[model samples]
Target: MLRPYREVLARPGALAFSSAGVLARLPMSMVGIAIVLAVPEVYGSYGLAGQITAVYVIVHSIAAPLLAHLVDRHGQARVMMPALRVAGLGIVGIILAIATAAHPGWVFAGAVVAGASIGSVGALVRARWSYILRDPAAIHTAYSLESALDEFVFIVGPVVATVLATSVAPTAGLWLPAAAVLLGGWMLLSQRATEPPVVRREAGASGGSSLRSGGMVVLTLVFAAVGSIFGATDVSTVAFADELGSKKAAGTVLAVFALGSMLSGLGYGLRHWQSPLWRRFAIGVVALACGVSLFFVVSSLPVLAAVMFVTGFTIAPTIVNGNGLVTSFVRPDQLTTGLAWVGTALGVGVSIGSAAAGAAVDQQGAHGGFLVVAASAAVAVVATFVALPTLRAGHAPAGRGAGPADYATVVPNSDPSA
Candidate 1:
């Protein structure tokens, strides 16, 4: 398990950028729960909290692909540095608004700014991996490692956010994400050696958007459903723990969930799959649906935690395969944009799920939110089966710039010896 990861990280600048990427992407896990905890405590309404979070996530979903396009056109440092600054300001605005008891409109405005500018650091990092590594097997291992790192982020971020929110100050939880973004963004952008070069288009050339591919569209929608499950689970678990008078324990429960995924991700990376990527993705989605359905029946915190851990087993494998399939559906030039679409779909689903679960929690408590989770999973299952034909025919159309085969250029220091 460690051998593959060691080989990948052995490439010069790989360890540096990936480490920085993890730091920068920490906000991905922290921001949702921080907002969920802070807004309700300050405003006394879970519905309002959810709405604010929805606004942020929805705008993020809209903005990430656009930012990624810019990155593809220009370069990561040039685009992401300014975007990170704007996002930092937005977070500051949110913190100030909440602290000063400013009008709700201020919060909404801040959310919009923050959401539109945060950009998908996860996509950015993965793009770096794709740029630097040439081997298909190496790429698979790298993605799996990133997924596991993502789980690690989730494990630590929520616990810190939850503790700060409940024990120190609600606003305190939001601060860490903001700080991480600044520090991590700088660290990542400063390492220019591993960044993917901008792929300029020929005059009059039109490769079009990655969304033009039917398979990509199908994958996006299915990912949206998966994202909804994530959103619903986060809000529901928080509420459930609160209801049981052990709110702090929400972090621990969520950590357990991530632990399962992280462990699985580590194992999944080591395998050499003989099956098609789409088939693996579909199976993972089905397993995820079945696992989440169990959430609807849990009556205690321990039971919920146990179910979450089991359900988590399906997440990383599903995501890694879905990302792998992106290469199958889009041109090499569209890699970043394509990956950002996956993140965008997830953000959109999370917005919907957060708002829906928030409303449901307000009406029927924690279990209501769990209902949304199960429902979202069911939607994912349906979408996956219904779109099976399209997913199986995963090649992009001809004249789409070049297929992912053209994606594997030899970047400097890509070798383990380097």
Candidate 2:
């Protein structure tokens, strides 16, 4: 389990930056939990809060790529600091708006600004990994590590978010995430080791430029489905929990879902065997779809948790394979934009899923939300299966750039010794 990402595990700086990204992302859960708990608790209306949440998500969907492009054009450090400051101010503004019981319009506006400015450390850190890991084989391993990181963030972030929102004054808890994002992102900026975008120069040159390539399209779709699964399910679970008058279980349920993914990822990493990449990814999609549909049947928290756990199993491997395919076609230059595509897909999907599900559940109820989530997963499963035959199977190792750790040793080549 630890072996694939063993190298990242060894690097304090790499791990630190990754952790910083996690800390930066931690507020996502807090935002969701806070909106769900606080707005409803204060206003006595989940429906209104859900609508506001939808607007917040839409802002994130629109803004992620713009930020990523800036990161690519400027330095990640250069783009991140201002974003962090903006996001921080937005958080404070949100608290003040909510504290004063400001009009719903004010709350929605604040949320839009906050979500839009929420620095995309995920893109930056993954780009950084592309450089730090260096070799293709290591890159796959690094991708696996990143997949695990997402699962980890999903598991822990929500739990902490919920605890703070429910236990601490909602405003106090807000500061934790705001302060954390500033500290962590700034710390990452200070690190000279973080990777920047690769600039395309002639055929084999490097500098800094935003470029996109072949596998990126597929990656975006894959992440869109993955992100939708989480977003849809979070809302579905919330609707399901609400059916029984229990909202506290929302975070616990998500945490269990992450736990399942974590275990699967560990097992996936340890296995020397990986399926044909597309097939592996398709299988995960199908599994996720089936699992999402099963959420409709969950009537209680325990059953919901179990369903989430079971469904979570396929999350990491799908990401590992999807992103591994991305690295396969990405050029040395334009690496950040290539990666940004994946992040963009994720951002868009999450926003759509959350917003759609929130609205769906508000109007139609929990079962309807599950159906939507399942349908999204099914789209990936069916599309991937259709494309499966024409595409390659399994994650064959390939070197991304000039490096010792690249897939050179594993993938077939004319000079096996090269």
| For model 1, the run of ten residues with the poorest summed lDDT | 409-418
**So what's the TM-score on candidate 1?**
0.90
How high is each candidate's TM-score? 0.90, 0.83
Q: Which tens-of-lDDT digit does each residue in 1-418 have in candidate 1?
A: 4899999999999999999999999888888779878988888887787778778887888899999888776678888999998998898899999888899999999999999999999888888888788777788888999999999998898788888989999899999989988999999988888887766555555568989999889999999999899889888988999999998788789889989999889889887676777788999999999998888788899988888888888899999988888877876677889999997898788777876887899999999999999899999999999999998876432212253334333323223221
Model 1 residue 176 lDDT score: 90
lDDT of 1 at 50: 70
Error of 1 at 271 (Å): 1.6
How does model 2 score by TM-score? 0.83
Off by more than 4 A, model 2 = 1-4, 41-45, 103-105, 197-214, 245-247, 271-276, 297-301, 355-365, 389-418
Runs in model 1 lying further than 4 Å from the true structure: 40-46, 239-247, 361-367, 395-418
